[model samples]
Target: MLDYKVRTYEEAIEVIKEIGFLPLTQLVPNYPSLDSITSKEHWHTGSELDPWLWRAIFPGDGVAAYGKFVKKKSVLISSELLPLTRSTLGSPRSVNERYQDGLMSREAVELYTLISENEGIDTRVLRVQAGMKDKDMKKPFDNGLLELQGFMDIVVSGTKAKTNEAGEKNGWSSTSFETMDYWAEKNKIGKATIKVDKAKMKLKDHFTSFCSPETMKAIYKIFKF
Candidate 1:
């Protein structure tokens, strides 16, 4: 029960952040009949979950079968609010890193609040399902998703305001941007030019040449900024 109950992808991330999503997403699928199951996986980077990927399957949870995951050690659990691990696994990384590897949604936030305020269970086993529509947070001053969207727009726009010795300013990760840009050009019908205008950047102007609103939101959320 460690994943947000989400219908659309955005609705899901709007609650749990990210830390609490990935593992739970995959685990639930494993046993469509299993309820309230707790599972863990090897956090490859010892950081947050890769912000770009949100699969309904967590193949890594079967690390025991592959002899890749340790058991009964303190492990970190990730969700929307922050990355934290209180696992019994004695994990090599900190709670923050574990949380990063997991993803959560905003609904998960309300779920946790509702549970803590009522359930009387001091556990963090979140489950994604159909429930009452939780109230929304006020318009975020740009959530992490928008923030990175803007930042990536700047980076992918292929323009830099300032430059390091190599001429770079405010340049975010190029690797992810390149992949996104390539796919965009290949798929987009208009195939407009993707350009970054640093001085004119605004979260409101989500017109990056490559990303759609949903994909932009998803990839940005993955970074957890």
Candidate 2:
């Protein structure tokens, strides 16, 4: 088994590069779950590692974190492998087609449009601009955001600490997001050099080394390919 004990941001980047993709934490709820096998003690929350610090380093760090559907939160992906991962899901074209076909929900379209127009946005501000500030709209807004992220159309760019009514820092932060294409352009990330089918096979073979057959099936299901 590969060592998952990452104690520093640099170490975390190395791990993500080796694995190609990894959930930020060990508590992912779906198959190929990190919860059972990954040691919690090495997590950002549990250890000296902090996710915010990692995000701060991501601008040119060659690693990125975004929703991957294996968990409720984002997954860390190495820049070298991001294009291949995108290929597995048939991105860009697929996301655009879904939007054109009206397969995307109204909320998702609104969120996408706003992000597209603005380039990038903080979550709190985005919620207000997208008409999702109401408590009742929370679930739909969150789901819509996740939908875009899962489709590889959007990704978390960074974060800023939240402030209270008095404008004091609450020590909690809201994540900021940007379209994947925007991120790629800014980071100089390129498209996959390998064919999509080859990318899928490569990822599958890598996963099989560490995951069970059942988990492998789940990975395929999660990627929808």
Candidate 3:
């Protein structure tokens, strides 16, 4: 459990770094979350203390990597732990190799290519660019995005507000996606090829300090670590 209720975004960042992993909401029983530790009153208030704001701003800043990582839910992982986490959860094969091997759908590969070619591409423009703007293509577009995020191939780097033709903000902000390799490179994270077995073992060992046996079980089951 958190030592105290988190009241600020800075504290939240420290918690993420200390825990190494945190979902936006509690997906596993007794698992820590920004939601569980923060006050609801402060949420969605467009303030510096808001946890919702932190999700978009904290990533790609040399502190954490954010994406739909755990159970394909929004999650934050410390930059220090990202390499191990990626090695454990992400496929060793390249996107092209996975597609050629029949492990990835064509739509997913296309989306990945678009994101790879243009870093920090938001889903709004991505859909139109990839010709997935039609309602019928929604599922495929969503699935492809989720697939890339689940494998740590892409991460939420930031957000962009929707602007009207008059140059005024309109709707809620659109999230910006970045290729993980590009993020790591820009962050100066060294490339490491850790064996999955070793990576999993290390991750579990790190979690033992804060996670209960049942929580660990749930983590392993959900993340398939």
Candidate 4:
């Protein structure tokens, strides 16, 4: 288990590297949430610490944060291990497959197409461009974003603070999303060396090594494997 007192981005990265992948909050048995493991007293009371970690690890030209795993939150999967995980999860579908599979909703296709066409985009701008600016579209828009992330078709590149009409910061940031292929290519990350079945077995063995049997059961339930 990681020392339950992470106080810095470096420490957080260390823990993530050790565990392979972890959630931002405590969920799976035996795995520690980023907040639960923080040593900073001020961070213990609420979710203030999460954004700091997000800002530090994402974007900036490296695959430091695997931003989609459980609960559509960040999952720290090291760049070295990304290929294996991607292989296990399966490849990103072509445009036709993505639309036809019934896995992606109409909003998801629109959002994904915008990101792909533009190379990358901030979430705030993406919503507007995708015609999801209406308040009623929030849930579907959010779900579409999560669905794309879950499928490994897209990933967060970084964050930009929301601003008011006066150009003042709103104290909240919107994440930037990009196609996984774009990010991987730009970063020079390679494709999976192993086949899907082999990747799955390897990933399972790796997970089993650190996660308890109960945790394993929970993982299986979540992934439905």
Tell me, by TM-score, which candidate is best.
3
Clashes of 2: 0
Off by over 4 Å in 1: 1-9, 14-21, 28-76, 79-84, 91-225
Give Cα distance to truth, residue 40, candidate 4, Å: 5.9
Q: Per-residue CA lDDT of candidate 1, range 71-184, in tens?
A: 211111222111111111123333234346663344333443433333222111212121432334322311322322222210121211333697656443221112122223
lDDT of each prediction vs. the true structure? 0.26, 0.68, 0.86, 0.71
For all predicted structures, in order, the TM-scores are 0.18, 0.78, 0.96, 0.84
Candidate 4 ranges with C-alpha deviation above 4 Å: 40-51, 59-63, 71-73, 164-168, 222-225
Per-residue lDDT over 1-225 for candidate 3, one digit per residue giving the tens place of the 0 to 100 score = 545478987888888888888889987778788899999998999988888998888885668889998777998888889988999888889998989988888998999999999899987999999999999999999999998998889989899999999999999999888899999899987654898889888988888778888888887875467
Poorest lDDT segment (10 consecutive residues) of candidate 3: 1-10
Error of 4 at 191 (Å): 1.9
Per-residue lDDT, model 3, residue 47, is: 88
Local accuracy of candidate 2 as per-residue lDDT tens digits, 1-225 = 343554566766666667666665453233322332344554456244654456445634446645544445667677877887887764546555787888777788789889888775888999999888999999999988878877778877776778889999887677777888888878889965577788888778776677666566766775555
* RMSD (Å) of each candidate, 1 decimal: 22.4, 3.8, 1.3, 3.1
Which prediction has the highest lDDT against the true structure? 3
Number of clashing pairs, model 1? 52
| Worst lDDT 10-window in candidate 2 | 28-37
